[model samples]
Target: MDTVADRVKHLRKQLKLTQTTLGQCAGGISKQAVSQWERGITEPQWEALNALQRACGVNPYWLLHGTAPMLESEHTPSADATPVGPSPPGHPGTCPLAELLDDLSRRLAAADPAVRDEVTRLVLRYLENPPAGARIAKAIELLLGEDENLPPA
Candidate 1:
């Protein structure tokens, strides 16, 4: 990627995460914040970059400097041992919610922009102040339609 904005957008796409999902992965940042980063309107703060590193195994150095090896695992130290961050839980080197978020992102990709925006806002709200489990299930059903593949609520 030529710029930090390009890198951020590429990383988000590589992770198959929507802007909202990526923001959530990066410590509950807003979708608008992610958008601004991708659009080169603003750069990510150090804390957000660190959270992205933890959330998605991004090499923070490469992310900022456009160096080689986009992923943390691909980098090798020439001198002192680099401090390693903890692997994300659920699956090795991945955000716990990645799969669910990817699926949701794909499902919403073809949605009307306004509809998608509204859903994203609702999701962010629910995340901030979570509702009952049944309420969450109902909201998902209402937004994405019933899916036989979804497990029992």
Candidate 2:
């Protein structure tokens, strides 16, 4: 990400946390403060940054200067290592649907209330209709905007 705001938003998304949730995890800060940080309206103070690092395993240097890894190296899994045993309860590996729902919730939390309601209605409608194959692909393209390189549905 190019800016601290981008990095902060990316970190929250990676953790599947809403702004309020992230704030809570980062030591009980308010959602408005998190929103301001994400919007580039104000930088997080040293105390908040330290709390984020301690509570969320964020790399403070990365959060501040953006020159290092986003997460502490010890908390991040090595790319080459395969997980050996059963995932812990509530872990993303143990419940992919839960993880996805958490991500959706995080996004919805950032949206305007009206937009959130509309999106929920649309999703419910789509679930009922359950578009298939080419229709699904077309819908995805419509939502994401067309990508020329995408194979035809």
For candidate 1, write residues 75-151 as lDDT tens digits: 65654543222222333542323344555566677677876776676554444343342355356547776444545
lDDT of 1: 0.66
Query: Could you tell me every candidate's TM-score relative to the true structure?
Result: 0.51, 0.47
TM value for model 1: 0.51
Q: Which stretches in model 1 have alpha-carbon errors above 4 Å? A: 80-153
Q: How high is the CA lDDT of each candidate model?
A: 0.66, 0.61
Off by over 4 Å in 2: 74-153
| Model 2 lDDT tens row, 1-153 | 888899889999999999999998767889999999899998775446657766777866577667657877545546553322223234544322233334445556666687666655554443334333235324433443433433443
